[model samples]
Target: MSKSSFQGTTRRGFLAGTAALIGAPAFATQPLPVQEVEVSQGYDPLRPPPVPEPPVRHNISSFQAKHWQPYFSNLHNGAILVDTQSRALHFWSEDYESHMLFPSSVPLSDEMTRRGRTSVVRKVKGPSWSPTPSMKKRNPEWPDYIPPGPDNPLGTHALYLGWKYYRIHGTHDTRKIGRRSSNGCIGLYNEHIAKLFERAKVGTQVLLI
Candidate 1:
């Protein structure tokens, strides 16, 4: 072939190879089309998605588990710590293998509050209720006796403390838990107190703080 013809052929081959290299990347890197979701009835394509409402929060800053060592000299016959500040109860079995924490209702005010150490002298299931003289004096209309049942304020179980007129017991009214709503006793939910009753014995060491 002639030199001019040869040069023209070479230039055509170079241009074809360069074009293929450039076009290959453009096609290879192309993005896939996004599939459209099926719209339900009343759906608005122009409207933004709904924002969810924030979760409701309760005042439970100190509602956490605690170790059983600091408050008790020993875990003899099991130990219970009632934290009035946190509105919680901590229990540890005599063996120290079982530990449980529960929300509690403390006394309504300083006058009704009792702090210090005590022991469970009695455990009564379906305990009867009677307002103390002071309680009745404060509220004359209060009932003199409440039989063991749903209406009883002592709830399903009661762990009578060493101190008179004091007990760690259950309450049928769930709203009282995790608050200061009791007279002089530490109160737990009926279900929680039932469980604690099974774990605690007659001589369980108790401390209220």
Candidate 2:
């Protein structure tokens, strides 16, 4: 005879009794309810999380050394190359011993841009500013003139070019550097301009490209 029959108890009945004896719940014999999880559309639980890309920096200008021989015949007084596309200025000393690269602000638009050769005709420390007739026509509300001071548009110093109404100058608004923010001028930082002013002569050769 089987053990269950000999004991006068069935196998299933014995197991249920044992479960109760062990303090197992009455519903322990029944199947568990299925759980529902809310997931977003197109989301795959098996997929690995995506990595984010690095942010692009727009404000920084690209600076590099350049050869003066390709651009100029000779570094007579000195040579200054203003690269509008790169928004940078390059300077080479007369003896070609010293070289400097400075971030600069170029013309705001193509219409305002004047390319080709020019020379530093005059340099003024604590320079005054006067908006051109074209600038005045464009912005009638702008001031006619600005005296040399902190409020001056041409900050600290100015290098007047051979071209009429064009200058390589310093700006009080430093944000203008490494950008296309000038009406028709190439702009530099006050400190950089001051250094350039010291090294550069009135006859410094300038080329805007």
**CA lDDT of each prediction against the hidden true structure:** 0.69, 0.70
lDDT of 2 by residue, 26-88 (tens): 213342232222211221121122222122222321444456788899999999999898777
Q: Model 2's lDDT to the true fold?
A: 0.70
Q: Per-candidate TM vs. native?
A: 0.71, 0.71
lDDT of 2 at 56: 26
Q: Which stretches in model 2 have alpha-carbon errors above 4 Å?
A: 1-61
State the lDDT of candidate 1 residue by residue for 114-170, as single tens digits.
999989999999999888999888878788888998778888999999999999998
